[model samples]
Target: MEQPVHHFSELFEQLGLPSDAASIERFISRNSPLPPNMSLSEAPCWNEGQAELLREAVQEDADWAEVVDHLDASMHKQQ
Candidate 1:
């Protein structure tokens, strides 16, 4: 279940910049490290590491349950 890759084309359009892979990568890596135990749904507040890891987990193209387990962002302790 490969997730469709996300591009920042629309964001670039809105912000009026020429967005590309390098641009997106630079933008992401520019962020600060995030803390563990923080809710990812409230990301940007999350450390850069956590946010990037979460993004990787998502882009891995696994099932949602598998992604949750890997990222440990489960809504339930066990579900």
Candidate 2:
């Protein structure tokens, strides 16, 4: 079965950002290139904190893993 697609707003909060919709949109738009063609773990746009959080989420298959994985795949798709 396919997993449900949650809003990126939750992810913004998880990454220690404001969880507002407009802010989320702005962040994604501003973080262009998103380190195109690179792995999410190695994406240059992520700050040290953001990268570490993502790494933990993905590596541990945490509750946020699905969202983080979705983001990783989406980032590549947009490239």
Candidate 3:
């Protein structure tokens, strides 16, 4: 069976965040360059539930992992 594919907006929606393209861009811009030593799930921007969901997605390598990783990469990018 194939795992479901996920998108950045879907990941954001899953985390109860604004999922529009512009909102996602603004969010990434505001929070980009996450500390090199920090994990996305540990970012202060996330609520406990959101953080847990991120952690689980990564730890389990779930269907959400691709988009989660994308978000992490986007945040770590230099402006």
Candidate 4:
């Protein structure tokens, strides 16, 4: 069986975003705590390609699932 990679940098790369420390921190802070009631797919922060990759990662239970799930939850948390 194939093992899933659980690295945050891996997830960032999969999403076509920068995986460097500063870039990762900036991405998380900018996109998280998304607008109230906004789903991950509905967040205005993601480009179409990024959003599609995220949706696939969550729905497919892919290697990036854990990070994507965390992101989804974090984005939905109440302000």
Most accurate candidate by TM-score: 3
lDDT of each: 0.43, 0.75, 0.92, 0.78
> What overall lDDT, based on C-alpha atoms, would model 1 receive against the true structure?
0.43
Candidates sorted on TM-score, descending: 3, 4, 2, 1
Cα displacement (angstroms), candidate 1, residue 53, comes to 18
Flag clash pairs in model 2. none
- Give me the overall lDDT of model 2: 0.75
lDDT of 3 by residue, 1-79 (tens): 9999988899989989999999999998998789888999999889999999999999999999999999998888888
Best by lDDT: 3
- The predicted structure with the larger lDDT, 1 or 3, is 3
User: Per-residue lDDT tens digits of candidate 1, residues 1-79?
Assistant: 6654433444333334446757644544453233455454345534565455555545664333253343233222232
**Could you give me the TM-score of model 2 versus the true structure?**
0.71
Find the 10 residues in a row with the least total lDDT in model 1: 70-79
- What's the C-alpha lDDT at position 34 in model 1? 32
lDDT of 2 by residue, 1-79 (tens): 6655556778878788888977766666666446565768787777899999989988987778888887776666563
Show where candidate 3 strays beyond 4 Å: none
Error of 3 at 60 (Å): 0.6
Output the lDDT of residue 55, model 2: 93
Pairs that collide, model 1: 33-47, 33-48, 34-47, 34-48
